[model samples]
Target: MTVPANVAAALPQYDLGAEIGRGGMGVVYAAVHRPLGRAVAVKRLPGVPASDERMSARFAHEARLLARLDHPHIVPVYDYVQDRGEHLLVMEKLDGGTVWSKFTGSGVTPAWSCAFGLAMLSGLHAAHEAGVLHLDVKPKNLLFTAGGVLKVADFGISQVVSEGATLGTHGGQVLGTPAYLSPEQALGNPLSPAADVYGAATVLYELLSGRLPFDGGGGALAMIQRHVHHQPRPLVEVPEPLARVIMRGIERDPRARYRNAETFAVDLAGAAAGVFGRDWLLRLGAPIHLSPQVAAATTRPTATPPVVRETLDIPVRATLAEAGTTPVRLGAETLVPAARVLAPPAPARWFALAAALAAAAMIAVPLATPGRDLPVHSADLSKPVTLGLGDPTTAHLTLTAAGITLADVPATAPDPADPNPAAAGPTSPLTFELPGASRWIVGGAAVATVTADGKSADYSLQPVTHPLVSIMGAGSAVLLLFALAYLESVLRSVRRRRAGTGAVVVAAPLGFGLGVAVWLLASVLLRHAPDLWPALVCGALGAAAAVCTVVAARRSALR
Candidate 1:
């Protein structure tokens, strides 16, 4: 085989095989470690000039960042070597395809969608924590492992965030994949982890609907304009709860969206759990089942065509041993064959139903007793509480208590800009610190202190988030949600005389019950401190979940 100039350097350590993937950055070749015989993918950056100082450092920075991150969902980097001035980024070879490579017109199921989101979120969360930001997040950037884990890949345009500094120092001046750019990013404004949130949400939206939220047939510039100002098409195909989660995640206002990728992921997992419970991940299963068209698209020549399409390893150990001789489903949209649709276990179904009934019973029984009203206005908030603030993050809150001479509780108040969400809304604002808001935004510290009479006093203050309200409201929400599911199942079963209809009917309530039950318990336990921001957040979530029940039932009926 004729070794390309870029492929020569890797030849010593890695037996470079056929080219499997290519992009504007460079071509990707399959290579086997000479000593270990481990399969890997080596991407040689043809665009990065070995002579350019800034570009070289930037590329090196990206390589170091990826190498530092250790997460199952983020692809690991084995080595970054500039073989003769041509940068070669050797990575743990993934066999599953990219999400875009196998995106089918049929769209992704809710369980799979949430699972994929969770995997991606887990990776992004790790990146954010490590002070790295994935500026370009899109379907193409997400690769699946042979085992079907969605791994976040491609930090080509990523940058490191300095401690306490919320803004990024790299990739700011340049545009990344325009389709997934956050509104703030598109406008060329300062960015935080929230920008990545928008990108993840965008790709997830595409995965769920099998289409881009903002379709820009008009052109790239026009599409950028739409991304900046456009409202996405309504998500009626998905269950309403899932739809609301997606909508909120992609909110135009960064604040309106989940504070970070973590929150976005939690909601997705929560909603999926409600529908699929502990078995949600299983429901998503794996994806090697690619339609011929999608599989073909991955390998087809383009202006910047990838050498490998969906590595079935759909982009993997089984990475096309022979590039074209073997039809490899290289990248995955994370869609398994429809034949593998595993129905919920019988015991799981019953367990979900029983839990739902228990919740409903709790709510119903409480209502019959006098003075059992939920506590909305009443909550205990007399104690002082503190949450941890990591490096580059700080906190300051004024404590005023008469007769309780306070110790040096910083006379300074937390920044108004970084107001506590729990302090204001019916829900407590999630504790998220922006890298850009080090000097201003006030975040809760991990350790809080409230001293009496100029000395530190022992005290435990719970968030005044009204635990009664949280519990009672959660119970009521779940009860209503279950009722809606049951109604829908009944209607759907009657209309569709298909075989195994009873199982479908039973599964509807069970899926919804598990989801609602899990959500209820999580809400109650997590909101024990009684923060308003989360309450409001939970309220919005509840409404969305309820709406999902109605829409899902209606859609099932129509189907």
Candidate 2:
């Protein structure tokens, strides 16, 4: 192919090499500073008319705008020069490809997406302080260095937002990627730094939810119309705190978003810390494996960064579904994402599914004696009764009879969990004694009833827990809770297939205790005919509590 005149032009001071990258407005060449011998990427601004004062002014203005910004997250300009009628900008050469390249194959996660937002906004915040608005803020323009540092790039289409200011060659027109365009910018109205914030938020929503906010698939004009009138999908599908911050950023009215990029960063920092610990941010970027073509385009040798396997320990309450399921590896040569394997179904489930697990253990430990059977005890007269086993479990009654007196018991007498007075201490092979010519059935097929002198009193009973039964019950419950928690995590994963939510680092311990408690309460209240029915009812309640604990945390009540 013939060399274009713009590419052939000589700038004697800098040595330009092969064209490594090309875009609509210019071609990027690997260049070196002649005197300093420093490597840089030189961008040639082509198609400028020699007599166009406005274009000339815009070129010079672009130089000044790029020169003023000084932030680690921004691609810095090294030199600006004009050769013949062509203009060129020498900038820091990034060996790691654009953010766009990373997402084309393996998808981006929410934590890393927020991490990019934090870094990208820092640059935008600096630009706004310098009075410039990055009209185009999309994934294609965001770049990552070889060190995995994400930077906001491509200010060629940006403009200064200062009053009555005309800085670049955009010429007062709609400027930005169509999919991420702000409502005001799409309408050809004046731009603000908030518009950039809107653009950044759109990118975040896409990462977190895994779909374009409004993907009408309509061409350019249709996109502008949609942005002007249509609202994006709800962010509620994602986890809390993080979702709240994103929704505010993409609000249709600029006034509703964080007033400045700095404010938005503050909110973002809190959310990233809440959902994914602050130290885990690096893991988000480490999973991305750039294509060889993208890496070869850079100025240096590329080594695919090691997949960060450093397990992100999300405090049980703070995090949700993890991306541990097999990652969709791009190709054999391309590196796979971090393997986030969850706690495999807990060992508790093997026993939890059957009531006999606990009942059998209870009987086995207490020593079964061919099983004794007794008739149902019932009476129509006032009476008192006492029931006992090898171990003592409190029996609560609605009426005072014999040595049995109503005594108040603490909700957690045995350490904050025993809310039933009826279960004072009744154990295996229970025996019942009735007073005042009344009848009582203890540990029998019949519900214990005491009646005397044409008066009757009945009381609901707490399961007479054995020491072994309590130990085994607790173990079974923990496993049951784990199974429930894992199910919840799976549900969240399916729901957030678009966005990569974190994993269940520590299954909700508090929720587990609550689930066991609910199960106990339910079992006591459900004194059904078949022994299996009561156990099944209580188990269902426990499972519900475990699942709800996770669902309630991920979902917002107000939303």
- Return the top candidate by lDDT: 1
Q: What would you estimate as the lDDT of candidate 2?
A: 0.54
Candidate 2 wrongly placed segments (more than 4 Å): 1-10, 48-51, 164-173, 282-559
lDDT of 2 by residue, 136-230 (tens): 88887888787887778778767777763432334333445677888877766666788889999888876665456775443456776787798
Q: Where is model 2 poorest over a 10-residue stretch in terms of lDDT?
A: 310-319
lDDT of 1 at 205: 73
Query: Backbone clash tally for model 1?
Result: 61
**Cα lDDT, all candidates:** 0.55, 0.54
- The local lDDT score (0 to 100) that residue 484 gets in candidate 1 is 57
Among these predicted structures, which one has the highest TM-score?
A: 2
TM-score of each: 0.49, 0.49
